[model samples]
Target: MMLTCIAVDDEPLALRLIANFIEQTPFLQLVGSYSSAAAALRGLQQQTTAVDVLFLDIQMPDLNGLELARVLDKGPGTDKPRVVFTTAFNQYALEGYKVDALDYLLKPFDYAEFRRVADKALAYANATRPTAAEPALLPQEDYLYLKVEYQLVRVDFRDILYIEGLKDYVKVYRQSEARPLLSLSSLKSLEERLPARQFMRIHRSFIIALNQVKSVSRSTVQIGSATIPVSDRHREAFDQFLSRWK
Candidate 1:
């Protein structure tokens, strides 16, 4: 099922960008576009159809996105549309999540980031609604849910470079990200969930993505300049795999 959405931004360029993004996505349908929060509120009140998501800009002349979100929260029933806050300021991110926003997009974001948030909104929308006899929209299987602090963060499998075990926790290193994601999860538990063909546990504390391995030696493997040790227990298996790979 297509998820209905609306964009509200005082800036014409930003509003147009979000609208275009919504139109380009197969699962998202742009139902409304408003220049201000007050106008968006009025439009939403008049609409007979339910909006599944809102791409809202936090700063505006009056009735800012956060205020509008509060108003919607107290409006009527619990079927309120999920919010995804968009703003240039990073300060509002904590506030946005406190209001239970589905996602947050910073200004100057590309279509790829927008699409990621859209997918999250779609998954949330479908999960909350009643199941229909018709087959539901199939969610993409290329992602993994990692519990980061109090929230479950969706991380794409392709983005993962390696995972390092730290006692009861694991640090997930990604391709482009400078800092790894720290989760209260064991390496053994995550190893079970990872695709065996794509991932390999080369040491007691480390699991590396096979395809991300840039180079290998008798005792170590390199991924994007990060050298990870291959323990004696796993060296034979790694050598066997390398022989087959060669």
Candidate 2:
């Protein structure tokens, strides 16, 4: 079966790029493309049937990717389409998975990576129709890959100091480097998949490795100059995570 897909991005060029990529994939049927999350919502509402996949962009003007994903989640029943988050920014992956996206795509992604994610989405979509239960989402082993400018780089969890989400992107602050590396995975996705015994979500935008955390303040937690915020939602959990270290 073909995977029904849609592209939702604020930038016209971004939308075009995804559209072109989708067209090249044999199993993906470009069911719809929208320049805004609002338009995608309208299309979802007007169309009685469900879509197989969504290539959702996170940084739209009014209705951002996260909001759109949340809206799509409340379907008529449990059976619904898969989501593939597409964004230039990397921090939203954690938030993206909370809505259960099939995969995350960074901007300027090559065709090979596109096919990899598209195939996973196809499998997830097809899995729904089988006799067995929905497959348990698995976590990655060894390391995670990130798209940086023109190259694909591997980042081991041990090297990270903290991660901060910006719009659709994530800034991975490292222990050895002065600069933070940007990646396509969201803070939410990282929070879920990353070994929680090692990492802590201290804020909505920040996730820090428990061993890497040097000190804590009323407003922030520090790892070098990378001061991660402590938000109300994460405060209690972070406190508990820290207590284990104490």
Candidate 3:
């Protein structure tokens, strides 16, 4: 598979060198090359598909490479571009891994070194890339993939307690877990994708599995230790659903 990529560096020469290297690589495709992080970000925002990899320079004006990496890491999509930091300094190497960068290329490096890391990134991209067929959402399907921290995590539908919306993100509460799975997706998007017969949105910000509901009060639904509010807008529908249980 051809891995689409972009390069960002403050140095014009560095950008040109990386672009040239990418062009020569058979499996790599150079989508864009920018002199600054902001320009690269703007260009990425305009693209319909996420670039497969990014060759980033850590020390850039306005917005440094590290900050740019963090922003792209939390991008609003399942396919987050893998980052390969290109810097002259060795100090930021540790910081690069913190953001889960695929590889690092120290400056003054040659085409051989670039090719080595490029090959590694390509392998990773191919391994993690989802299959062409979308996951079936059948009634018997017990699990689904949720994009969390640049990785797609498989979550069993039965393990889910409820989902809480937090602006552009969602906190997926599941059984036997203290912390929720935070994902870069809207609750509405997840609500629409979930099996409607098994799950219901009881509030604008909440969606609960029908089986997980323990009890229903005047305006709240109980599930284990959590008490999720049933908003007026959703109350009538929820009442209709609860009627079937009786």
Candidate 4:
């Protein structure tokens, strides 16, 4: 798939360089290029088509790239663009990952380095791309496979007590196991794959099995020994689900 992209840099040369690189890349299509993060934000808001990727420079005078990434990360829209931080400084690398940036391109980077991160961004975009086809609910399918340590581990849905999201990874708590299954994946992706009738996202960082919830105490849910918080965003839906149970 051809991924649409935008570049945001305070420097005219840097912005032009990224734009040129994007044009040279076969899979990437440069939709917009801006001299500031604010202008890029406005362009993103006003654009007709959803931007799939963002090539952002970390340092800027107004609305720095990191702050812009955070704003887009919490956006109400589900089709949030993937971020690739471009900066001369290496210190912002850790912070960029916190916002779930797909890659980081250091300043003075060669075309080869740019292409490598671009390829990674394209793969990520395609993997998380939404499809018109609805997922089938296979009731008899009790287990799901997760790639862990380069191996696919089978995890039974009935054994799952709750899921705790840790940035790009998730810890799946099980009934019988002492240690939770850790895997490299986003909570949103897993939530979409699981059967919605049996599982519900109670918080931005938690998803619990309806059958495993022992009790609900105000804004918290009790499942086994763990207490998961139900944020205000998800509380109303949880309350409605409880009402249906009654």
Candidate 5:
């Protein structure tokens, strides 16, 4: 399968070069190329098709590549792309891997060097993709098990107040609980399991139980004492839910 990819760089020359490489590659399809990290973020969030790979330059003006990668990783999507960092300095290589980067390409890299990393990304994409025999989503259930530290804790859907995403972990706040139950999972992962009618992701960091919401404003959702902001990206869906309730 051709891996769908995007390249982001502040320098026009660098961005053009990366775009050229992506177009020339047989297994890679260049979907979009952005001159800034912010533009890339917006494009990825709104795009309907899932991107398999991201070719990013580490240093940029407002939002750097590493920061952008983290945002995409924790953002409201299940198909998080494999990142390949491109930078002039090799110093950022260690930080790149912390965000689970597929590979690092130092600046002034030739077409041969770029192709090697592209090969690595292709191999990874092939390995992780789900086969026809393996279903992506399982049958929905009332309660789901979460890994809290070393123990597996079960949380019921009806009892859940809301869920918070912090980097790689999620905090599940349930009814009558003073402290939330922490789990080693992404909001996107949990989102897939939760019943759509009962829960809604109001923000990048929060997923609220629809039935438990006390009130909702133009930009926020109230659940008990906690108020969750409805992100601009998710506002339309939140508005639609309000219309349905009306």
Candidate 6:
């Protein structure tokens, strides 16, 4: 059966590329391409059709993929499509898992691996919906443990947006109504501690949630209309991340 899919990414090129790839892949039928999570939700809400898989990019302007996944779970559909996250960073892997994502692809992943992951997701998307007795229907938890005030804290993985360097201190952005920017210790030092799957070093200064960003191109990441520069050193990985979207 053709697995119907809708890809949501921030880059126009990435969306076009996925569309092209869908055309060639017999198992996947391209349902739509959305430049932002908001756009995808609008179309999906129109109640026009059903999709089997989601090729989702994490970071976006209005609604990021993780949040979008949570939204989809509440939709009228009895069962939701399998979600596969496409991102450049590795730090958010645990969080993606928390969102019940089928798989997480690091930026610049090999095309062969992508196909492999896609195949698995297709099978899951087509599997029988969880029955009331099945625990798979429960919301999965993704969190990072932290020691604060003589106690351990279980922070929901998706609460973070960015963690900034502050000499010796680290500030974590948590579940605030608005996206939070945090202060943190040395960027390099913190990078070592982050989960390799969910976080990536896009620049010497910034550690973005692999699933939080909206989109990217050769030059910049779209933060609003402003373009955030992609460091020359990170170009290769960034290009690879962008290629899958293509």
TM-score of each: 0.56, 0.53, 0.64, 0.65, 0.55, 0.50
| lDDT of each residue in 1-246, candidate 2, tens digit only | 687788889889888988998999999888898998999989877766777788988888999988988887865765566778888788886787667677788887888999999887765555334434533333434455555542346677889888889876789888767899976556786677677777888778888888887887666787876666899988788777667667
Model 3, residue 70: displacement in angstroms?
A: 11
User: Of the candidates numbered 2 and 5, which has the greater lDDT value?
Assistant: 5
lDDT of 5 at 183: 76
Tens-place lDDT digits, model 5, residues 1-246: 689999999999999999999999999999999999999999998889999999999899999999999898777756899888889998876576557677888898899999999887765655446557653224455777665643346678899999999997899998968899977678998998898988898889999999998888899988889988999999989999999768
Candidate 1 regions exceeding 4 Å error are: 134-246
Stretches of model 4 off by over 4 angstroms after superposition: 131-162, 165-169, 173-193, 196-246
lDDT of 2: 0.77
lDDT of 1: 0.85
Off by over 4 Å in 3: 12-27, 36-50, 58-142
lDDT of each: 0.85, 0.77, 0.86, 0.85, 0.85, 0.67
Report per-prediction Cα RMSD to one decimal: 10.9, 9.2, 5.8, 6.6, 11.3, 19.9
Tens digit per residue, CA lDDT, model 4, 150-209: 334678888999999998899999988899888878999899778888899999999999
Model 3: lDDT of residue 185:
77
Number of the top-ranking candidate, with TM-score as the measure: 4
TM-score, prediction 5: 0.55
Candidate 1 C-alpha lDDT tens digits along 1-246: 799899999999999999999999999998999999999999999889888899999999979999999889768875688888989998986566546677789999999999888877776655445575533222434666775643567777789999999986899999878999998778997887787877899999999998898888889999997999999999888998789767
In angstroms, how far off is 96's CA in candidate 5?
Answer: 0.9
lDDT of 6: 0.67
Alpha-carbon shift of residue 3 in model 3 (angstroms): 1.6
In model 5, where is the ten-residue run with the lowest total lDDT? 133-142
